[model samples]
Target: MSLIDLSKHVALGIDIGGTNTKFGVVNHRGEVLEKGNLRTDEYEKVEDFIDALYEKVHPLIEKFGKEKNFDGIGVGAPNGNYYKGTIEQAPNLPWKGVVPFGEMMTAKFGMPCTVTNDANAAAFGEMLFGAARGMKDFIMITLGTGVGSGIVASGKLIYGHDGFAGELGHTIVKPGGRKHWSTGSEGSLEAYASATGIAITAKKMRAEFAESMLNQYPEEEINSKTVHECALKGDPIAIEVFRYTGQKLGEALANFVMFSSPEAILLFGGVIKAGDFILKPAKLHMERNLLPIFRNKVKLVFSELDEADAAILGASALVWEK
Candidate 1:
């Protein structure tokens, strides 16, 4: 074991995703000095997961501490609650319910630890160092398997009454329409706006257009990326799907803007890579739906932060701020 120094100002950032858990050492300037990832499926139990995390991260901390001063640790995960310092009912992880994640990490590393929902963390990362930097009020939306959001109003992350306030994806956009049997819901924003949701919508549209180029891909293997590629190649069906998804998102965003009156709306995640296919239509719809006071007032933008680094930065910002 190497002798560790305590004078360094680096903080550890950890982002736990459905497929992977990423960790990094970052400075106050948001420069990531070291980073790594672990497969989330490798562990069967939460304890096993934590043990593996410690095994991988402890060495980095020791190494960095030997060469520079280091601070604490910050974490971001699905269903994470900052107030409880726990992750409750995360859809991706195998853990059954709430786990004292922050306390467990602190106990293992002997450092201060904090945690927040992945979306909230990303929002904070964006506000502190990414696209939303310098903006006081904004909404950050992550459009992945599901639509996740972080609401910042008056320069603060709104945790609501129970730390579950920013579930923009679950908001109902269409009542008594497009029912999802899994959750017993009808026409949720996520059902149409997320990557999986868009893929489902694209598949349905593909059935109506027998001449669509998307037929090149098997029906069982269609994905958002495939649809985007086809749309970029001028496939009408693919284009329509993008337009529809964006329209739904835009309408939902218009409602959010009315309530929050945010300065900007920042979009992140893989699905947004469709670029103009999604953004242009979303902007048009949002503008069309907005009230006279909000029309043309709020700016819609993309995340400037590196996609791979966002979660880590967000997680690390929690402890770094301390």
Candidate 2:
């Protein structure tokens, strides 16, 4: 009988999102052994944030370390630079300026750490355990509070020269169009396609139709989830918001397909819960804008990973990376 070695297979994965931070212990097969989350907005100082994280995450590490060799830590955050292991002026994070996040983690946790853009980590996760497995080229787009993208070519996440490549969300799709809340960029894909953007769209469009279901909620209460709820009930205004958002997303995707000619484009995050309301239009517009040869070739699909788990899995996959 053959015995499986548990050592050298366990890792800690931390996903630092704008609103929350999620962490977990994972094995080599991308299974999350245990997980928890903390509010990212609660800490004004990065040090406090790290300390708080350590308090919660250390026990899991201790639990797993009893029998297995722990393989260090991996982190995914907005604007994280893999080459430098830093988070530079991430608009969504409370911390200002460049933060040596990797060094901080190593110092705090006594483990080697690797950090990369959150979207890039998602791509790695997809390659390692999700739909992109065995594929040489693909794109992963995360539509959360903001839009983010990770590009993989020849089975490698493209870090570019600065380790910040594949920011498709910030790419200008509509010059002088909607403005991004954080970057203040005009006409970017993120302005119209993100979950935040969808809510904004709903708020704006609802005013035009007095009888629209979206008008029921107070202005502050309107959000993507509420919009989705209205959309599910066949509210025309909510449905139109998604259609408009999808149109913009599809147009941007057409450009991406042309640039990389990837085999597929995988969409992830809370916005995906809208299902075909967003997917149908995105696929339609993407195909409509593409050249004949490029049309009908690129597969646009939702991620297979559980939304709550993908970030942790992605973060952990970085640990196993060569």
Candidate 3:
């Protein structure tokens, strides 16, 4: 059976992450009909990943084929480029070089397909169904394995000249400071603010406080979530790590605000799970660094959207916009 016709209703939203790929069929009313996740490591090659996704999605499309109509497929992926329709050198994905992502998905699904960076997708998702709803200008920051950002100016996603704008993570926070864990991008904010970055920072702090409860966990199993749990339990080291991370993030956002003057900066993803540990410090530093004119004018808020459903909603919103 064929997918829903464009002239009908709703759209398919696909969010491809480093660890999982999530997809859903959503209508104009922001209601999701069906949604699920697939492990990203199952596929060896890029083509294999595409095939696996279609295999999983095709059944859902057919199952809902007779009930609700899907207008198109919208995909949100790491390193995905909107203009080029490619996932170019994604750090987490095993795929090398540029993968013709949109073309391949379109061919497999026999429907209109649109692709954008996961950050951009998240920002649009917020605008369409989440925190930024009804807002004209804001920034959405995804604080996960890495820091990803989507900039909306004048109510439009800033694609930049090369369709790679709004890369807030790669913006230099510490000039000539350190190398990024994945991309080797020097002094990038991801080096210090991502989940991995937080873990790295935590590891350093753990070494200094050898008697802390954090030592109870095996090093291999440690993660940002674990750190948050430890901090909540009054682990000074963990708290310090979050404070430091948030401070750095705030400093970075302060610079971004100077350029964009956004109404709010929305935070999302796993690292943000640190909640006040991260937000408080970030707000403190952001306020300290901002100019008087911008101070107290811009707000920093958390994404009310569910992380699992956001990419799908964001991706679907991309097609819905078109």
Candidate 4:
């Protein structure tokens, strides 16, 4: 066995998505020095995926490896646990059962490893290198395919007893509304405030209002990005779509603020790129729903993270934490 250096200032970050696995080597300054990706769906077994990952990532690890200067690896995945370093029965992943993910990566790479839910990793990235820098108490909300959250209190990310805490996305926002396809849960925030939720709403709006500019696009084409583009073009129906989405998101956030009393709620992900078209209504609704004490206190802001680097940076940030 060859000796390894454990004192490097740079860390390896890996963000495992359902479709792709993004990996990178990053320094403490939040800069990614080397990066690459692989199609996750290509590997049927988790072990195969890990082997492919190790094969692909090892060259960078060796090239960037400096004597006693390289930090360990960090990973972010759906339903990942920091304590166990395992990926639980994630609905989106190819694996069917709990996989000892972090341990596998550590052994393959020969270094320390930490794993956490992607949302939690995003919060870490925000705290270490993005908007939440220097702040202790805040919540990072990811409004993507599904709503995801990471709560920070007293400057620490809350992991709860089972390491599955901070699932604000599944909280009931509408008591009897749409059913979540995966969990069979009705009216959850994830069903109302996510990009999928927006697409669903767009369909309903298209049906009710014939004048919708969305009518020009096919059903499959009516996604969040299209809606945002139409809204920017002064399309009334598209504008209303964002309005409704923002209202629900805002109300849910208002409740979140009352419970956690966070200083700010940082919004991340592609949907927020709609900018004030979504944020204005969200901010208005959030403040309106907030109690007297919390009304004017919590700040609603977009993330400062670079879309390209955020995932890797967030995952890498965990190495520093560990």
Give the whole-model CA lDDT for all candidates, comma-separated.
0.87, 0.90, 0.87, 0.87
- TM-scores for the candidates: 0.95, 0.94, 0.93, 0.94
**What lDDT, from 0 to 1, does candidate 3 have?**
0.87
lDDT tens readout by residue for model 1, 63-171: 9989677678888888999888899998778786889998998888898888889898889889888999898899999998888999999888888988877999888
Deviation in angstroms for 65 in model 3? 3.3
A best-first ranking of the candidates according to their TM-score comes to: 1, 4, 2, 3
**Tens-place lDDT digits, model 3, residues 77-108:** 88899998899998788787999989988888
TM-score of model number 2: 0.94
Clashes per model (N, Cα, C within 3 A) = 5, 0, 0, 4
Worst 10 residues of 4 by lDDT: 2-11
1 or 2, which is superior by lDDT? 2
